[model samples]
Target: MKLIAKWVLSASALLFVAYVYNGVEVRSFATAMGAALVIGLLNAVVRPVLVVLTLPVTVLTLGLFLFVINALMFWAASALLDGFVVRSFLAALIGSLLYTAIGMVIDSALERLLVKK
Candidate 1:
């Protein structure tokens, strides 16, 4: 149930990024759903390995490197999905930033709402 909620949050964030970030657009609910799945998978698989591999840089940067990893994962998901196209590196970076920001917001909001209920 928590996992489902997490995915929904991710989907919502991706949808927002598509709307506000750049040329990226999720044409339908199905496309957004698919993009969410890919994003989750990439975060599950690629993100950990990336974090481990870049642990030194991550530590050196005072945890800021995680943002880069997050952005890379976002770009990877965009690359793997259809109907979701980031126009350039800058767009991808902004999209990635928005993805993280919105996801964090959604998660915290859900936590606040559900924990009280």
Candidate 2:
């Protein structure tokens, strides 16, 4: 149940990102959910490998390079989903940051609400 809630929250965050960025478009709520799933999977499976590979750069950049990895993952998710589109790397980066912020806030709120129950 909590997992489902988290997934829905993620999808909602993606929708918010699409809403805010002119260069990003989500065809529908369903497409946003699909995009969220792809992003979750890529983050789960691919992001760790990329993180390890780029550890030196990450260290050199003082951890800021993780944002680059996140943008790449966001763009990759867009490529995998039919109706979710990011027009450029810049758009992807902005979308990624926005999604992260939105997701963090939603997750924290949900955690607090669930904890009270």
Candidate 3:
């Protein structure tokens, strides 16, 4: 139940990102849902490996390089999906930041709503 809620909210967040930023475009709600799932999968499966491989650069940049990795993941998801488009690396960066912020809110809300105290 919680997972489904998170997925739905994540999709909505994607649509919100598209609506707010001209650089990122989501074609429809279904497309946004698909893109959200792909992004989640990439973040779950690939992002850790990327973080490990880029540890040196990440450390050198004092953790700021993680933002680049996040943008890459965001861009990669757009590349894999037909209906979701990120215009450029800069767009990916801004879109990812917005999505991440929305995701954090979703997570916090879900935790409060679903977890028993």
Candidate 4:
């Protein structure tokens, strides 16, 4: 259930990005679903590798480098899907930051509205 909630949160984040940023492009639900799959896969598969590879730098950055890994996953997802496009690394970085913010917001709201019930 938590996993499904997370996926829905991520899809909502993608939709929000599509709406707010000119640099983000979502062609259709098919593409969006593909992009979301890739994004989730990359985060799950690549992120731990990246975190270990950059462990020293991550420690140096006081653990904030996780955000960089997250951004790279977003950029990679953009590359994999034509409809879901991020214009550049910087845009991807910003989009990822936005994703975190939106996901947290959605999670909190879900907890309040659903779990409280």
Candidate 5:
């Protein structure tokens, strides 16, 4: 149930990102959902490998490199999907930041809601 809720909320967050950021474009709710799933999968699978491989740079940057990884994942999702588009690397960076912020809010709300029950 929690997973389902997170997926839906993540999709909504994607839509919100598109609405607020002109550089990111999502055609519809379904496209946003698909993009969300791709982003989640990339984060779950590719992200760890990237973190490990880029450990030195990540350390050198004082953990700031993770933001670049996040942006790459976001841009990769846009590349893989048809209806979801990120205009450029800069767009991807900003969009990823907005998406991450919204996701953090969703996770926090979910944690509070579920823990109280």
Candidate 6:
């Protein structure tokens, strides 16, 4: 299904981040998948609430503060998962940014490919 493909794309992005950054790591494919699920859930459920609560700062910063929220969610997922490790907050921030960039690219590509089918 589309959701499964999206999850796989996210996990692939996480794996790519782990490969690119020494400070971020995943013990296995399963761990990466788990991390993807946790990150997705947090983004879906918690991120909106945090965004609403921080709307003033977000508006003040021209939406830059959303990056901080994304980093926090990434770090929280690392803390919750035993096999996924983020060595520092900076690593989490970078990883979060990379994952977003990579996921967006992959999603757009997949969307185009699926539409042509």
**Highest TM-score against the true fold, candidate:** 5
- Cα deviation of 15 in candidate 3 (Å)? 0.2
lDDT score, candidate 6, position 110: 87
TM-score, every prediction: 0.85, 0.97, 0.97, 0.84, 0.99, 0.96
Better of 5 and 6 by TM-score: 5
Clashes found in each candidate (C-alpha, N, C closer than 3 A): 0, 0, 0, 0, 0, 0
Please list the C-alpha lDDT of all candidates, in the order they appear. 0.80, 0.93, 0.97, 0.82, 0.98, 0.94
Clash tally for model 5: 0
- Candidate 1 lDDT, tens digit per residue, 1-117? 878888877877788778775556777667788888998889889899999999999999999988788778877877897787777666766788877788888889888988998
Query: For candidate 3, what's the RMSD?
Result: 1.0
- Residue 107 of candidate 1: its Cα lDDT? 84
lDDT value, candidate 2, whole model:
0.93
lDDT of 4 by residue, 36-78 (tens): 7788899789888899999999999999888888889999999
Assess candidate 5 and give its lDDT: 0.98
**Please, what are the lDDT tens digits per residue for candidate 5 over residues 34-117?**
999999999999999999999999999999999999999999999999999999999999999999999999999999999999
Candidate 1 vs 2: which has more TM-score: 2
lDDT of 4 at 28: 73
Across 1-117, the per-residue lDDT of candidate 2 in tens digits comes to 888999998998888888878889999999999999999999999999999999999999999999999999999999988999999999999999999899889889988999999
Model 3 clashing residue pairs (backbone): none
- lDDT of each residue in 5-89, candidate 3, tens digit only: 9999999999999999999999999999999999999999999999999999999999999999999999999999998999999
Candidate 1 vs 6: which has more lDDT: 6
The CA lDDT at 72 in model 4 is: 92
Model 5 bad stretches (over 4 Å) = none
Specify the poorest-scoring 10-residue window by lDDT in model 3.
108-117
